[model samples]
Structure formats: C-alpha cells, structure tokens
Target: MVKFNVTRKETSPIDGQKPGTSGLRKKVKVFKQPNYLQNFVQSTFNALTPEKVKGATLVVSGDGRYYSKDAIQIIIKMAAANGVRRVWVGQHGLLSTPAVSAVIRERVGADGSKATGAFILTASHNPGGPHEDFGIKYNMENGGPAPEGITDKIFENTKTIKEYLVAEDLPDVDISTIGVTSFGGAEGQFDVDVFDSASDYVKLMKSIFDFESIKKLLSSPKFTFCYDALHGVAGAYAKRIFVEELGAPESSLLNCVPKEDFGGGHPDPNLTYAKELVARMGLGKTPSQDEPPEFGAAADGDADRNMVLGKRFFVTPSDSVAIIAANAVESIPYFSSGLKGVARFDIVLLRSMPTSAALDVVAKHLNLKFFEVPTGWKFFGNLMDAGLCSVCGEESFGTGSDHIREKDGIWAVLAWLSILAYKNKENLNGDQLVTVEDIVRKHWETYGRHYYTRYDYENVDAGAAKELMAHLVKLQSSIPDVNKLVKEIHSDVSNVASADEFEYKDPVDGSISKHQGIRYLFEDGSRLVS
Candidate 1:
C-alpha cells in the first residue's frame, strides 16, 4: 500500500542535541536545518523501544510559533512511518506546555483513545521567529516531562543516529481544520487527529476552580483584573476563559493575539521583558495615582510561566506559591477535600534554588511538608508524580501544583483571583477590596521577610566561574579564614556560621541529586555578601 518513496538517509551525529530538564531548544534557523529536527525526533523514538513506538498514540503540538506547523507535519509523517497508531495535534498546532500535559492525562477522544506521550514544541519564554528560538520536548503518559532516564537515552541516540523513518507518501494533513485524516501504509492505518486546543484544558481549570465565585469577583466594580499574554499562545485561552467564561471585559486583555514572532518583542514575563505590563501597572520610577487595574498578570511565550502584579507592586514567584497554597484551602474548590500530610495527600511544598525561605514559615504554619530541590521544575514534577508534592514553584516566575505536571500560567492567575474573591467577598458594595499588596504585606509581617535579592554575573568566563566556586569551596574548609577574608574585604562584614555544597534526596523516589549549589550561611541566617 505504501507507494511513495520513503528513504532512510544516512546522517552523521550532529552536536548539541542534548536536552535539558525540559527539552531541546535552539534558534529557529538551527531547527530549520535539513534533518536536524528529524534526527532528534527519530532519536526520541529510538530511545523508546519499538514496542513503545509502534501502535502508540502520540501528541505533537505546541505554541503557534514560526516552525510549529511544519514541525507538526514532519512529526506526524514520522509517527506513521514508525508504526505509531495515531497522532494528535492541537487545532492550528497550538497548545501550551501545561495544556499538553493536561491533554496527555485528561483528554479523551471520541473513539476512546488516549495519548501515550507528547512532543511539545516550545522554547518557553524565549523569543520566537526566523532568527529567534524554537524547541521540542517529550512528555510521558502521566502528564509530566520525561525524566532523566529517557532524556539521557535520547541524547545518546542523537550521538549515534544514522537514519530516521518517515512516511513520505502520506499527504500533509490540514492542521487548521478540526478533523481526522487517515492514511494507509505498510505500518498499518495511521490517523492524524486535530481537535480543539482549549476545551479539555478549560474543563480541567473549571474542575479545579469555582468559575461562578471567580466570575462574581470579576464582575464586582471594585475588583479590576488585567491579563497580558505577551502575544503568546496564552491569548487563545485567555479569551475563552477570562472573557467568555469569567465575564471579564474584552478591553482588559492585552496582547491577547497569538503572534509567531510575539510582535517582535520578548515573550518572557518579567519586569524587564514584560515592559508593557510593567508600565501599565504603574511601576514606573515616578509612581502616579493613575487608574491602574487592581490586579495584573502576564504569561510567557508558551503560557507555562506567569508574572503577577498589583497596582504598583510586584509579587515574587517565591512568595506567590506560598500565598497560593495558604489560600487554596479556602479559595480553590479542588482542595476542599483537602491537601494534608506530605506523603498521603501530596502536601509537600517543593522549592528550587532561588525560592524564598518564607515558604518554610508558611509550611510550618500550615503543617505542610517541604523540600528544597535544584533549579528545575522537573524535580518538582518527579515528587508530584510520586504523590509527594502538591504545590511548588520557582523564583523564575513558575508555579504549578499536582493538578498538572507543568507550571500553569493561567492556573496561577485563577488562584490569585480566587484568593482575592475569598478575602473580599463581603466588599461587593463598592467598598475597599483586599488587595494583592495587602495580602503580601500581611504574609510578610506574619512570617518575617527574608530580605532576599540576587545578582547575575553574566558574560563571565566559564573557567573563572569554576575557579571562583573552587575557591569558595576551599574557603569553606576554614570558617575563621573565610570570616577573616570577609572582614578584610569589608569592615562591616559579618562572620560565616557555615558554608557547604547543597545536596538533596527525593523523599518520594529516594533518588539523590548532588552538586545543587553552594550555600554560605552567615551568623544571622543570611548569606555572605559578594
């Protein structure tokens, strides 16, 4: 039945195919290179056994970036050649990273089929375009990023990849149309299913949150909310959820149109990158009493990252997780049965390197368990899948819970809205509402702030960074010498209480991940100043 030629072109090993915790991300040109994306995709299939690749339903979709459409078609053909049962693509090849995870876990087809894994194409908050970034990553059936075991194998396969299989005769299915296209081949009957991108994800969000309560809050005149998608894929869901489902006005949504190049702006959601949102939130140097929105937020390129802000105030991601967890019991309906016992109910608060220490205080007050992991969301996902972590986040504007394996941007916004609604339920008569800053300040006063700050030493030589780390480690061998050096550097410097390299073991999986980072604790529970 296979008529067209499907050749296996011999290729040598290409460099830099290794994926990090999430996926392989590179510039659009790099991915556009002939056979570069193919080699990686084949290697991913090679990593898994033929049994796994054959007759398996896989998801292939991502943020509507520049190359996503082409990549989806290529992957679909490859899946057919590899004897994959069926392939699922989001409508118009658009699905956020979190949404992909949700689809892998919760999505069900009319034929009662489910996805085994997904190839999520995204570069996260990285800018996109012909010259900017593009990416692809694999997720397992549990709706989480593939662990190191599979990624390591994939990298190994990339190094030795010789050829890849593809169904050359299979015509390109129209991804824009929401329907199924079938092709018969030697492998068997193959199908490419294109479906609505937002319905399954929206249902998941509604199950976790009470839309009516949040809608009432959104309708209150005293409660004004703003969302900016940064021209990313989040725009597709923002309208369906915020405006259509929650009754928010259309004007409140900024940059709610998905753009392949993100309107020539960076898609990362931070103070510097999210310039439009920062300006609109009245966070300029000379703050004015302008009629700014009460609450504002932005999602990164793939909609897996978020930045939360209030009138002139910005909420740190470290504090955001704790605040969400502290309020989820009363605000979010999903936690009603409730989250308790770190092991039993997935109550552990897994934090990464730069997460605030204030979370520890909240965990103690709430009787929640906690773990300190390296700077990667995958580590938290591991604990989450093992039924240990319920809520976790990073300092880099990432937040998610056990509801999904990925950090969800829209979910974070809804959590904040829920908290606001719960705290200001009695203030519907145009009275003063409980503000984001007020809640943050109350949290600070109750738990005591960490006075946390970080510095970036960019463009530093790798050799110099290594030498500095070695010198710091050597200094740790003698606290008195370290303190003496510190005093010599600055007269007002304090003595070091302890210094050591950070190491952690996952309580759920009992896996030890080493060389996390170095922590130099000063006498007053603070770190040494550079």
Candidate 2:
C-alpha cells in the first residue's frame, strides 16, 4: 500500500512565498525542506472549493528542471487524495508553459469533465540545477495563472495546514504509456492518463500557421536559420515542428534534447544567458565557411520566452510584438481567414507600461486599439476575455494573445517566419532590409523611441526597500519642497505628474496587491527611479 507518511509541521518557514511577476520562485534549498512542497500543494487544493476539486479534470506538467519529476509525483498523489477524477499529465513530465495552456484550452470544455486548471512546475528563465531555484504555479480554468485573490488564499492556508491526505497505496504507473493507472482500494477506479505533451499544441499551431509556406521558406536555398533549444522542454517541440514538420535539417537545431539540469547552462534566451546563440549568430560560418547564417532564434525553459536575432542584430520583444501585429494579416492564417473582414478593427494591442512605445506608432497607423497596463500578463487576461484585445506583450521577452493565456515562444518564432515570407513576397526591397534590427529601426523612425532600461535590485532587505520607496513617495507628494539641508533641484524642470507605489486590482475578481512596484512618471518624455 502506498501511504503518505505523516511529518511534523513547523510554523510555515515560507512567509513570503507569494508568487512573483510570473510565479512563486525560490532557491531549491528553500523548497526542498520537508513538507514545503506538500504545504503549498495542499494549500492549492484548499483554494479550490469542494465542487471544484471533486471529480475534476486537472492538467499537470513541468519544465523538466531539477526536482520536477518528484514534484509531479507528489502532485498526482495529492490530486487523487483531493477526489480529482481524472488528470492529464505530460508524458515524462515534460510540457512547455504554452503547451500546458494549449492543453487546458483544448481539453477543458463543457461536454467532457472541464479542466479545472493546472499545476505547472517551472521557474521560467531562472537558472535550473541542484543549487538553483525552483517554482510552482497554478493556472485557473481560463488557462491563466490564479489571480491575486486565489494566490493569497493559498498562501494563507499554507500557514496552518496540519495534514494532507493521499491514497493509501497505489501502484506506480508508467507515465510514457497512454493509459489509465488505477488508484484507491477499489479496483479500476480513480485513474490518470499520461498524454503526449506536444501533439495537441502542434495541431493547434498547424491550424493557425501556414506550415507549407514556412516549409518553403525553410527549404529556400537563400535562407539559412538556426534554432537553439537550450536543452529545455522545447527540444521535443522544436524537433517536431522545425525538423520533422518543417523539413529543416536535423542539424539546424542545437541542444535538441531535454536535460534535468539544462546541462549546466542557464536555459534563458537573453543576451546575457544565451551567449552561445548570440556568439554563433555573430561569428558562425555558413556552408561556405565564409558567410554566417541569415537568422537565429532561441527559446527559454518552459518555452514561453523567445529571443530573435538576425546575423548580428537583436530584436527587442516590444518591437517584435508591434511588427507581428502589423503583419498579422499576412503572416498568421488565424487572423487572415476573413476574421478581420468581419471585425475590421486594426489588430488590438496591449502592453505593459515599461515596454517600449514602438507599438503606439503601429496602432496609430493601423487605427488599432492600444492599452498600457501594469507589468504582468494577468492584467491582459481581462481585456482578452472582454474581447477588447487580441494581441499583448511584456518587455520581459513575453508575447501572446487570445490564442493562449501564456506567452507562446515557438509561436512567436513562427510568426517571425511568416512575416519574413510576406516580406519576400513584396518586391519593395531596399537598404532597409526586413531583419530583426530593421524592425526596431523602422519603429523608432516612425514613433520616436522611448529609451528604456530596468534596474533590478534583488534580495534587498525588504524593510530597506520599503523605506526607500516611502522616502520617494514623500518627495513626490511635497512638490517644490525639500528638507532643511537638502534642496530640491530641477523641480519645475521635471514635474512629477504621478508618484505612488503601484498596485494591481484584478478586474475579474476584486483582489488587490498593495505594493507591486514603485513608479515616478515625469512630464518630460524621460522618467526615472523605480
């Protein structure tokens, strides 16, 4: 009999385990403590009402990072204990963030047992290893992360969870096998089905994209591209989509195998962490050993973030979203299939405040509806659900739309390919080529660029950070005034139109976060001090 051993409960050592901009993240050591994962999992189960838990269909998967497999097993046991009837887990515990979202939307419906939600094990672009960080996030029925209200309830329950229930003894089932594994004392009763992680997602992508056109672009003699998977979960998807489906040579992909620890490399697709891809794009020799490939791309762990580069040029995520929205009709088949004919509203776009204003120009030219929300994808969920927005993005290398609740890294890459195909169709070729860098330059030329940079101060004493923010707030409120010794310089030159700590209230639910971040907006185009 598989019985859960009772463990001593200590005062919750994780007071600040609240989810971050994406999800709850902390060092591996922190989550490895006995009953740490259990408390959180139980709290998650508690967040769901009895009706939401009993006989519910749940989706489960992870990024294949350190402790992912172990976490999946524990969650399976807990879900069964919580009276969940069926669970759709990724084969071998491998599913990218976007893939999980795709599964929830495709599998969860009225006819079948609606997918109550999902529990994804990932720390996103954060480093993964024995010593690095790990995380867990719960997505709601809408395939988006649990809103602030739900997360706060989970945190509150964690503080006092005395025990967690589980099946007495169940046979370990094969995760790769696509069949049911019985649980509980009754024979052939509660069960779980291990599903292929990439099948449904690939099918959806095929429906939305013109794979034949992309295949032609991939096979073109004039085009040469490289896709680096960073040894993350996307390796399988990339191999299937880029190699098997698109007919690209197997060698076109680098790091095309999933590893538990990402092979000692930080699986983040950025200039700092994805230096290998950057170096290859800048210096790798072509088939002639004299010229480099024309394009290169990379996706982060969980495959929800992408970085695009062309030869020696880098494309910012803000610019990427704008360009894709502008070319959506030509590149993506979903938008092109007369859907625009009915609505005719220029691609609706939304972005976080800190993101570059490049999209404003595209929105103005195309007469599209544009919105600026706080720095989190959850804020876009309301607009998308209300049918007011179709495309949205964040400056942190994230982009997605109503297609999926989370950012779709491979989708974005394919979107770029479609745009390239459209550019090739047009004969308006000039010195201003259709490269990743060209997209930014064109956007800047049209809409004066907003010089943007973020300074991240990590692990600062929480009290000190709070105090500093309070001082800034006081200064902003008392305009044109200063302390006895200190004089206010440039007061009139830079009028602080607004200065306050940021808070986000969920439109769907009235949950509120008092202090998300600090902001000081200036009248001049430039703003400072976060």
Candidate 3:
C-alpha cells in the first residue's frame, strides 16, 4: 500500500475573500493566485463541524469549466490531508450543481460510505474561461448551500486563516475513470472514488416522474420537443435523460456536448444568452425554414437554472413556478404521493422576494401554505427541511422542490414535460396537442395574470450603490412621499399604498434576514422592488 504524508503549509489571509449566497466567485486569474483557492477551501473545512471533516466522506466536482479539473485534484488532496476518509469525484470532473446535491444525498460508495458534504466548482450561469469566471461553494449534508451561519464562519476563518493542510506528495488521482483509489495515511486510509455523473440523478428523476408517460408524449408525432444545454454541464445528463431514457429524438438536443468555455458563449438560459435555442424555437430575430418545435428549454453552466419556451413564446420563471405548483399534484406523481405524502391543498409554495406574486395567487386559490423569502436558496432549504415548502422558485430562472435542496434545471424541464404528458394523456394522437402556451394561458385565465419586469444596473460603484439602497430605504419612511414620486414618474402609474424594506423571518430557524430589498405595494396587486 502506498502511503502519503500530510503537510501543513504556512499561509496568510488574502483580502476580498468574502463569499455571497453562492460562495466565492471571481475571474480565473483571481482564483489562480497563490494560496487563494487553498485559503477558501481551508476556511470552509474549518467552518464545518470537526466530525464532518475527520473520517467523513466528501464529494468534489463541478461543471466541466476551464479550471475544474485542477480544482478537483487540489480539493481531493486537501480532503485527504484534512482526515476525510474518502472523496468522491464525478467522472471527468463533471457534475451539475444539482447532481452534486443528489450524489451527496443518494450515492453510496463501494465501501458503503455516504458523502457528508461537497465542494461544487462552477460560476453557475456566469461565463467561464481563463479570463472569465470561476467559483467554489460548499454544500452541507442536506445537499444545500451552507446557511448564512456557516458561511459567516467561513468568511471569518478566511480573514484570519494562517495555514492550510494538503498532501503534497499524494499523486493526483485520475478523475476521468470510474473507480476507487485508496492510500494509507497517518489518520488511517484515504480514498478517492470516481463515479458516473448521471446515474444517481437519473435514478432519482425516474422515481419522481413517470418516464413512460413523458416518453409517450415525446413519441407522439404532434408533440415535438427541443432542448439546449448551452454547451454547459447539463449536456452531460441531457443525452442520458432526454434522449436515451425519455425517448426524445437525438436531433432535438442542441449543444449537447459539455465544453469548458461553454463554446465561447454565455451559458445563461435566457432569451438573450441562449440564442441558438431561441432561434430554433422561432423566437429569435431570424425565422427558421422549418416550423418550430412545440416545446423548448435551455440550461445554464451548472444546470441549476432553466428557461422554458414554447413555439415563439417564453415562459417567465415567476409564471413557470406558479403553473408548476398549480398543476404538480395532477401531473407529477411524487407531489401527489411521495416524500411527506404531499396532497392537493397540502402543498406549500415559496418565491423569492423579487419574484412576482404569481405563485401567491396559486397558493391562495389552492389554500396551500405560501411564503416569500429572500433571494437566497438557503432560505427555501430551511423551509423544505422543516417540511414547510414543497415547491419553490426564483425569478432568476431557478426552480425546484423538496426532492433536493438545490434548484434543479433538468428537473424543471422534466416537470414541465410531465405536466404536458398528463394534459395530453388522452390526446396524443389528436389533430393538435396541448401546447406550453395553452397551459400557461389557462393558468392565467384561472388565476389572473401578474406582469413582471426587471432592470439591472451592473458594475456600479460600491459606495454609490450603498447610497442608492439607503435612499430607497429612507423613502419608505413616508408612504405619501413614495406615492408622490410614483405619480411624478408617470401620472397613469398606480399610487403606492405602502413601502418598506423587505425583511424575512425564517419560520423554521427563526433567523431574521433584513434589508433583502426595498418593496413598494401598489393599490392593485402590482408590486415594485429595488
């Protein structure tokens, strides 16, 4: 047996290591700095409970971004040195954020070990390359991003971190293969296991949805489908699930090959970023010679965000979740009789503060528990852990349920497909199938519609942005002043009935998150947030 020695390398804290809701993200050059990644990784291990590190299993993988291979090797060595009994890596160092979560929760090692945490490396929807962005975030045993309490500890540890542990003599394990490599160490034995990236996630998906029904819908001549992975990590699973398992035509997949640079395009699954998919769906600037498919979808870099589309139509994320929540009980079998045996009217739905009130309307009509949480997914994770939320989404193209703690892009696509299958169960051979647009229109007709739009001002000076937020908060002191300002902007605009800085109190944890954003409630059901 080969033996490896651990070395404690002396290091100093680097400035600007603070992590946001997603973890540390920066340009590849920034992460390439000496000890930069090491510092953050060490800080994360320090923030976790000692039991979670020593003699525990951890998974390390991410979207096949530019530096992901190197990051995976580094994290493996670090995990071994930190006394982690085993480290799991997805084959070829590829795993979507949601896949990592699923692996952590569902995958068992050959040695019968379960992962307690994971280091997910990807900048999500952000662009990636040598000069673009890179990121590393830690997920807990529950398969969710670390809560604020743990992240706060990580940031503090990063500030004062003086050293990191690594097994410098440990040869890099080949992450391209699916097998286990073991080594003897001072603590006992450290192992690195490389496994298939999609099996666990696919198995989970199969259990939640009726693939035969979705496959039947796909096989129907009247129901055409197209999916674009945007050359991101979603491509890794798209072929297995959508094509091999669900029986979609091979040609229906676009950019189904994962690329480190996302094929030199931004991997955000929106109308602007997913240009090729939009064009194929008949929503682009130039029309195609052939008719568009009945349904289309795209995924971001890490496959945690999704955009749903129909022929020449886009489904807003806010409306997507509401429609899913409204129909989940009937369409998805898991919602009707899985997990907590969730039933109609027993479902709980949630939306981020910035998301429109579309989901709230569904909740009211169904008499389901509803909550408006801050933008972070951790808030929803808390509710799901407490069995308080069954479905949740954000306006930023994220959607999921208690099936997994993290938002799941492919799962969202599968869910929409399930709904379509259920709606057309008896009509697959009819002259025309029920389209995505039809379902959305029916939802609006039943629950009324809420129009939502957002404008972003990026790269603003920090001080100016702070001042602007302060100004918005300050105006909330006087409702009349806000109303007057609204009227001044546009006489036809509705008057502001009330205003306040958004604050959320976690029902499960009783943690208060203040100043999530500034919101103005209108006389009608409309709302404006900043």
Candidate 4:
C-alpha cells in the first residue's frame, strides 16, 4: 500500500453549477476548467450527512464518454481524501447509469459491505466528445437518484464552496483490470475496487427474468432479433447478455463497441438519432436489402433509455408500458402473481404526465393502482421505493420497474423479449411465430389505441423559451380565450376543457413539487403541454 495525505485546496464557487433532475451537464471543455469538477464533487460531499460519506462504500463509473477517465481518477483521489471507505468501479470505468444503481443496491464489497451511494457520470442520451456534453449526478443507497431535498442542498453548497480536499499523493488505480488496489491514508485504508462491469447487473436481471425462456426464444429458428448499443456503455453488457447468455447471434448485434465519442453519432435511442438501428430495422429513409429482423432495439448513451422497434413498426413508449403491464403477469416471471405479492389494485403503474393514457387504460382494465407524475424519474423513484409502483415509463423512451431505480434500457428490451417468449412458447419449433406487430395489434385492439406524437426544439434562446412558456401559462388562465385562439388556428379541434400548471405532492414524504409543466386539456381527451 502507498501512503497518502489529504490536502485542502482553496477554491471558489463557479456560476451555472446547478444540477437539474438528471444532474449537471455541460461541454467537456467547461467541465475541464480548473476546480469546476472539484467544486461540484466537494459540494456533493458536503451535502451528504457525515456518516453517509465517512467509512461509506461508493460506486463511481459511467458510460465511456470522453473526459470520463480523467474525471474518474480525480473523484477517486477525492474519495480517499474525504475518508470514504472504498470506491467500487466497473472495469475501465464503465457502468451504465442503471448498472451503477444496481451496484449501489446489490453489489457487496470483499468485506461484505454494500455501497451507500454512487456518482453516475454521463450526460444520458446526449452526444459526447471533448467539445460535446459531459455530466455527473449522485444516487442514493436505494439505487435511485437523489431526491430534490438532497439535490437542492447540493446546489446551495455549490454556490458557497470555499475549499475541497484531495489526496494528491494517491496514485490512479489501473481501472482496466478487475482487482483491488489499496492505499494507506491518514484516515486509514482507502481501496479502489475495479470489477467486471456487467456481472452484478446481469445477476440482478437473471433473478428477475426467465433467461432460460428467453434463451429458448432466441434459439428459435422462426425468430430473428437485433440490438444496437449505439456505441454507448450498453455495449458492455449487450454481448454478454444477448449473445453469450441468451444465445442471440453475434451478427445480430450492432454498434456494440463502446466508443468515447459514440462514433461521431448522437447517442440518443430515438428514430432520429438511432439511424443505424433504424435503417437495419427497415424504418429509415432507405429500406434494407435483406429482410429485417423480427425485433430490434436500441439503447442510449448511458443505457437508461430504450427505443424498441418491430421490423418496420414502432411502438410508442406509452403503448409499450401499457402492453407490458397488461401482459406482465403471464410474461415475465418477476411480475407473476401481481408483482411483490400485491394482487389486483395493489399492483401499481405509473406514467409521466406527457405520456398518453394508454397505461391508464391498462391500469383500469387490470384493476391496478396507477398514477401520473411529472416528467422526472425521481417522482417514479419515490413511488417505487414506497412500493406504490411496479412499472413506470415516460414518453422520452424511458421505461423500467421496481427492479431498479433508474430507467433501464436493456431491461426494457429483455422485458419485451420475455413477453415475446411467453407468447410464442408453443410456436418456437413451428414456422408460424407470433410476431411483435401481431402482439402490438392485439394490445391495441384490447385496450384501444391512443395515438401520440412529440416535437422537441433544441438550443432555443433562453429568454425566448421563457417568454413563450410564460405566454402559454398566461393563456391557460382563460380557457375560453384559449379555445377561441385554438379555433382560429384549427377549427376542427375540440374546445379546451381546462388548463393548469401541473403539480405533484409526494405521498411518501409529503413534499410538494409545483409547476411541473403547463397543460391544456380538450373535451375530446386530447392534451397539449409545454
């Protein structure tokens, strides 16, 4: 072991250090500024209770984005100086956002210690490079993003931070290898444990899913599949799970190599960004020469968001969640028997407010508890922790369950595969297979379809965006005026029924979150939000 001493360095707060619900995101150049990352890291340490920091095991890793390697080393040294007991890192400093959450909640150290928290470093689905985006967020022990209370405190500390501690003599551990490197520090032994990136998460997934059934489905001659990691960290597990475990053909995987810059392509999983997968799935501008696979899926940079496709057909996130919930009892073994022993109304479903009412219809049909929260995973996280939610999703292609706090991209794919397997269990050897399109059509027929579409405008001038939002909110004050304007714009649209800024009051902690979004509801059940 190498001996090290903690050094307290003087510093000052930097502007724009506030973190959003996902975390602080900025260009790699901005994060590379001297003391910028340190200020935020220290502020986060200061925000936590002393016991949660001292002698606590923490996991630190993320999607293999540019500048992540350097950031990992800095955080390791700081963790040592801060008296953290151990830092668990995935091999090569790579771990999906959801994998980090699983590690926090499931991974046990060599000494039988479990992680208390994690610093998840990734800009989610954003592009990454030296000039592109980089990000950092903290997750708590429950494998969920920190609640607003902690994030608010972290923001407050960032504005007034005066100094930060670092173990300057601590050598950077070789994260490429799976082993533990220990350092003798003033506080005692500080260890950096580099482990395989996928084992713990795979174990968790195996526990929740019937891998044998999925393997049988993958082995079927009638079914063909494709998975694109989009060059994100999801690649780290795709081969291990899809090909090695579930027996998907190696040829079925696309862009499975982890690239720091995502191969110069946007890493979002939507049809707009997942061009390669879209083309292969025969949904792009150019049709595929070869027959498209029966099922295709893509994961975003951090592997928390998923876009699932069926040949040339697309499944909206709203329909995806509803379909999963409607069939979960028989499809996925984890959700068998109404999930966590809850029957009927005790089983919970959730969706973001912007999402269509597909899941609502399913919840009513299944007699399950349901909720519409704001467009943040934290809201879903709170409900999941309270055992009030089993499945939740957002219109932005994010989906997950109580299995993990973070939205799990690969898990969503596996869930789909599980459903496929359950549906075609008897048709595996037969030439006629139950196709994804067939299942989706059947779901729509049973639950009634809710057509949905979304448009996103990026890089708008902040002032103009704020003014537009203000105008929309002001328009909501007068439903009749809004209806008149709507009629003048489009005469066929229904009259406005009501409008308001969405608000949420947490059932568990009784915390209030206001102004989540602006909504305009029509008598025809159509809704618009900004």
lDDT of 1 by residue, 162-206 (tens): 899887777788999999887787656778899999999999999
* Tens digits of lDDT, candidate 3, 1-530: 67999999999999998888898999999999999999999999999999999999998999999999998888988998999999888999999999998998898877688999999999999988899999999999999999999999999999999999999999989888899899999999998889999999999999999999999999998989999999999999999999999889999999989999999999999988899999999998988888999999999999999999999999999999999999988899888773244455556899999999999999999788899999988899998888788999999999999989999999999999999999999999998889999999999999998898877676689999999889988888988888888889999998888888888999887899987888888998688888
- What TM-score does each of the candidates earn? 0.94, 0.89, 0.98, 0.99
Question: Which wins on lDDT, candidate 1 or candidate 3?
Answer: 3
Model 4 TM-score, 2 decimals: 0.99
Model 2 Cα lDDT, one tens digit per residue, 1-530: 23332223344434766676676888888888877887888888888887677888888888899988878887887777777877788899889999988888886433366677899999988779889989999988888877666887887887767777665344455777765665553322466778788898999999888998878777777777889989888897998999999988897898869887888898888777786777777843322333546678898888999988887777878788887887788678888763456474845788877777777777888777787777767778776767777888877888887888888899999998887766665432333336656655766787666666655675699999879878877776654453221325543455655666777665544556566556666666555546
- Clashing pairs in model 2, backbone N/Cα/C closer than 3 A: 1-169, 2-168, 2-169
Instruction: Report the backbone clash tally of model 3.
Output: 0
- Candidate 1: stretches off by over 4 Å: 1-6, 286-289, 340-346, 456-475, 528-530
TM-score of 2: 0.89
Number of colliding residue pairs in model 2: 3
Off by over 4 Å in 4: 339-342
Q: How much is the lDDT of residue 507 in candidate 1? A: 74
lDDT of every model, 2 decimals: 0.86, 0.76, 0.92, 0.92
Clashing pairs in 1: none
Candidate 2, after superposition: displacement of residue 96 in Å?
0.6
